[model samples]
Target: MKILVVDDEPDVRTLFEQRFRREIRSGEFSFSFAYSGEEALTFLTGHHSEVVLILSDINMPGMSGLELLRHVKHDLIPPPPPLVMMITAYGDTDSYNQAMELGANDFLTKPVDFTALKDKLHAISTA
Candidate 1:
């Protein structure tokens, strides 16, 4: 599976790589990283078809993840839309409601639980 991970924190890339090293090495998953929403959008435009899922941080510098979610859910009309999972340090009800309303597939509280994330990903892949 191909996944796009978007976050302003550079360390997130290394963290995910370390956490999912086995899966990546075994060819069960592949990942791409973007530092901002705008960069994520640009990557999607060229490689949307190859991406199966997107993990995005809500509080990004230029163009929030919610805004990106809107574009992914509405503007980009691909046949098999990539599943979007929003991650936020502030897991407020308002943000949760807005994310769900905007068509996010799932919401994950930071720091993410890699075990739960793996289960969710497995389920999605099977489905």
Candidate 2:
């Protein structure tokens, strides 16, 4: 599986890479990074068919994840949009509702728990 991890924070990207190194090493999954939503869209335009999932931070500069989610839900074609999971440090009802309305597959609060993330990924992968 190919998973795109989109966040402006370099540490978050590094953490994800480290946390998922075993999966990469075992060829179970591959990872990509995009620091901004525009960059993500560019990557997606060329690689959407290959991407299985996208884990994105909601509060990014230039383009927010919610905006990206809207584009993916409405604009992507043929194979459909990749599973989008939104992550935000400032989790609230409004953000949650907006994400869901925009077709986000799931939402996660910041300080992400690996165990929960793993379980969600497993369930999504199987489903």
- The C-alpha lDDT values of all candidates are 0.94, 0.90
lDDT for each residue of candidate 2 in 58-123, tens digit (9 for 90 to 100): 999999999988988898775578999999998899999999999998999999998899878767
Q: Quick one: RMSD of model 2?
A: 1.1
Clashes of each: 0, 0
Q: On residues 39-123, what C-alpha lDDT tens digit does candidate 1 reach at each position?
A: 9989999999999999999999889999999998888857567999999999999999999999999999998999999999888
In the order shown, the candidates' Cα RMSDs to the true structure are 0.9, 1.1
Question: Residue 104: error of model 1 in Å?
Answer: 0.4
Once fitted onto the true fold, the runs of candidate 1 whose alpha carbons sit more than 4 angstroms away are none
Q: How far is 1's C-alpha from truth in model 1 (Å)?
A: 0.6
